[model samples]
Target: MSGIPGANRQAPKPDAEGAGSAALGPRPATLARYLTIYAALWKNSVTREMMFKGNFLLWIVVELLWFALQLSFIGVIYLHTNRIGTWTQWQVVLLIGASHFIQQIYQAFFLINCTNLSELVRNGKLDFLLLLPVNTRFVVSLRQVDLGAFLNAATAIAVMAYAARQLHLVLTAGHVLTFLALCLVGVWIHYSLMFLLATTSFWTIRAQGIVWGYYNLFQIARLPDEAFRGVFRAVFTFALPMLLVSNVPVRVLADKLDSSRLPLLLVGMGVACGLVSEWVWRLSLRHYTSASS
Candidate 1:
């Protein structure tokens, strides 16, 4: 008799064994591994988008047309009045451009990822992600990129540049850097809130409608914060903070910040939203029942 159990049994084939071993290899450290994985994901996204050239081109055209329509609306509004609650025509244009920039960047990088969480939960595809040898949250939140949305984001930059010229706003290195930083903070705020909405799918099984309804609040970001008042203003400003996303950054760039504390307040709101979203995500995961169960 063999000394070891199964010593005389036929060995598994080398090809199968090697493949299994490779799949089970030790996972790398978080930051480096995450960077590598995200790069790969972005490359795969670009390749997949390129495979459907017509669809990609059509989406780009649609986004550009929508942007033009917004500009036209702004022009019509300005034709009637010199200013809308302290925002001149060009300032409102800048605000809308900033709003578009933040929204497009969120859509390009995080919107699909957040929205897909619901589908994965509904169909039990999340099990595949959970079984992977990497962080599930990172993988789930950044699996794809929308290249057409990124192209639209570039158009937003052009709009902002034109608005700045119309307002004769001098752009300094510091101002540009501050604007970009605030824009990213705005994007992060949107991502956190949207992800929180999607995370509810663990309980609801389908949260796409709720996720999109939350997205509609972003339209209010394009308007001047000063235009709102009383109860309605308090709800969005303090509770939701949707009004602050584009408004603060535009105020920073336009030298229209009413208080020195507005930027600080916006940053605090973004941090709070991110922390709350992460907590909700962890809690929601605890409630998830795998499809097999």
Candidate 2:
């Protein structure tokens, strides 16, 4: 809105020199314009990342080590017992891999942007971003991309492949596609919840602790949902829905759908979370007091 000039004015009369080109070329649609903007943002991010190749590579190694620690924790549990709540070792590995993949995808695309919301608000940097000629939420939620996090997600995929082999799971094209799709659903659930937490910055001085706290909650996602009991299970599976994220997709691959309705429930939860996050973001914008004001 701020970039567009003379919204009420008619199209300007073209000079004879460029009249033919102006008449033949149509204006880009709104969605197309936004897509182009997002592409440019990604390009800039990639360019900046190239300038810090060492840092990028270092982060990838650190994440891989972190993932190894998680797998080691699972291995320790398996040494004591073969299964945790009806899930075999390989099945649990697959679930943890799915959780890691979802978490990385969310981190790569959205986490840094959402986390920056608080800093933007604190320093009044958000005022300029809000004035950009695009949806405020879109600008805030997708201005940065972390290639390291995205590349690190490949480790999870490799682990999942090994687990699938151990479980003797059939890997049909349809099955693989469904698994990936469900993983994306898991990512959406994370993005929505994290975005909601980040929006708390509109009221508080800083909400990074709250947002990072939510990141720590992903540990629960890697565990078997059945291991949780009573109110704890109920709250995570439905209220927060964190347990459903990786568990649902892993169950589908392992042919362990306890209820035929689990998939439907997971999809419904993703949609509900997305809608709630959007509504809350718009509401929070109204409360934002720019630095100048």
For model 1, the superposed segments whose C-alpha errors exceed 4 Å read 1-29
Clashes of 2: 0
**lDDT (C-alpha) at residue 117 in model 2:** 92
Overall lDDT per candidate, in order of appearance = 0.82, 0.82
| Model 2 spans with C-alpha error above 4 angstroms | 1-28
- Can you write out model 1's per-residue Cα lDDT over 1-293, one digit (the tens) per residue? 11111112211222344335434655343344556877899899989999999999998999899889988999998889999888899999999999999999989988888888999998898888876655466678879889899889999999999999999998899888999988988898888889989999988976999998986798888889999999989988777888899999999999997676988988998888877877787788777788866
For every model shown, the clashing-pair count is: 0, 0
Question: What's each prediction's TM-score?
Answer: 0.89, 0.89
Clashing pairs in 2: none
Clashing pairs in 1: none
For candidate 1, the lDDT comes to 0.82
Residue range 1-293, candidate 2, lDDT tens digits = 11221111122221233334433545455445556887899999999999989999998999999999999999999999988979999999999899999999989888999899999998999888766545567777788999898777988999999999999998788778878888888888898889999999999977999989997789999989989899999999887898899999898889998676988888899888877887787788778898667
